[model samples]
Target: MATGNKEIVRRALEDSWQDPGVFDELISSDYVGYDPALPEPIRGPQGAKDNFKQYSDAFEGAHITVKDQIAEGDAVATRWEGRGRHTGELMGIPPTGMEIVVEGLNLTRLRDGNIIEEWSNWDTLGMLQQIGAIPSATAAQTR
Candidate 1:
């Protein structure tokens, strides 16, 4: 049996890669992604797909590497790094031809190989600035 931690991580990566039918194969109907940017939690598989699509569209050639994952029953905690380039429009910002490497942690709840809930801690603003979307005038000035 795949441990809950392993299964959840596998599903999360599959979803991130924008694999067709990933959600249908591994996610629950009432999945809730605890991302700060979304006004409301993703309510279903399609909503989850939308979230993944948003990410995949923005970060082309994106890759994720898991540093560590620990499991406690149904919940799993992970530390990971994801890297990609801004090859297309991302959050209303056109391609900047910049690459971003982000490191973050996430905790997820799983049941029956389906994702139930997740909380991700990532540097959103830092990622934006790295990709040259956010104004880095202050950073430039400081430098």
Candidate 2:
């Protein structure tokens, strides 16, 4: 069960970006996702699709790599790294054409082989710095 649950989460992270349809298969209708970068909680599989779309729209050829995963009972925690070229506007920051790397962790809860809930925490500030939307700490200190 643990291994299966981990695979479910792995697929969600690795496959969802490329194929939105994966959400319909792996996410429950009642699925809810919490992410620090989001202004509100994402509800249902459609919400997940929309959330991923936002990033995909902003980053061309975006890909998420699952770095580690641990499962216990009905819960799976996954650590991942995402990389892409900033080819479009994101969070109001225009395209910089810079390649960016961001790491995050997602804690997913599954029921009957489908994800029912998830919580994500990622390096939003670091990403902004990499894109020049916000200055890095070193730059701020030097100024």
Candidate 3:
């Protein structure tokens, strides 16, 4: 069961963001997401799609690589790194054509093999700095 749970999360990470319908298969209808980037709780598969769509739309070649994963007692935690080019608008910031890499970890809880909730922590500020949306400390220091 632990391995099955882990596989489900892995498949979702690989396919769900781009194929919105995959969320329905992987995420529970009552799924809720907790993340600093989210303005409110994510409810259901559509919410998951919407959350991921922001990144997918912004980065045409975006891809997430799973660095590590662990599963226990109906829960799975995944550490991942995502990289891509800034080819479109993201969170209202226009594209800067910068290649960016962001690392994050998520802990997902499952109910009957479906993701019921997820909590994520990621380097949002670092991404912003990489895309030049915000100046880095070193860049600021030089001015």
Q: By TM-score, who's the top model here? A: 2
Highest lDDT against the true fold, candidate: 2
lDDT comparing candidate 3 with the true structure:
0.89
Tell me the TM-score of model 1.
0.86
Candidate 1, residue 27: the lDDT equals 70
Report lDDT (Cα) of residue 17, candidate 1: 77
Candidate 3, TM-score vs. the true structure? 0.95
lDDT of 1 by residue, 1-143 (tens): 33755766765764457574777766789877887866787767788788777778887888777888888888888888888888888768888778998888888888877878888888788888898766676877987
* Model 3 Cα lDDT, one tens digit per residue, 26-66: 88989999998778988998888888888899987898888
| Candidate 3: clashing pairs of residues | none
On the 0 to 100 scale, the lDDT of residue 54 in model 2 is 80
Residue pairs in clash, model 2: none
Model 3, position 84: C-alpha lDDT score: 90
Name the regions of candidate 2 deviating beyond 4 angstroms: none
Q: How do these models rank on lDDT, best leading?
A: 2, 3, 1
Give TM per candidate: 0.86, 0.97, 0.95
Q: lDDT scores for all predictions? A: 0.77, 0.94, 0.89
Off by over 4 Å in 1: 135-140
lDDT of 2 by residue, 1-143 (tens): 99999999999899987788999999999999998877899999899898888889999999999999999999999999999999999878899999999999999999999999999999999999999999999999999
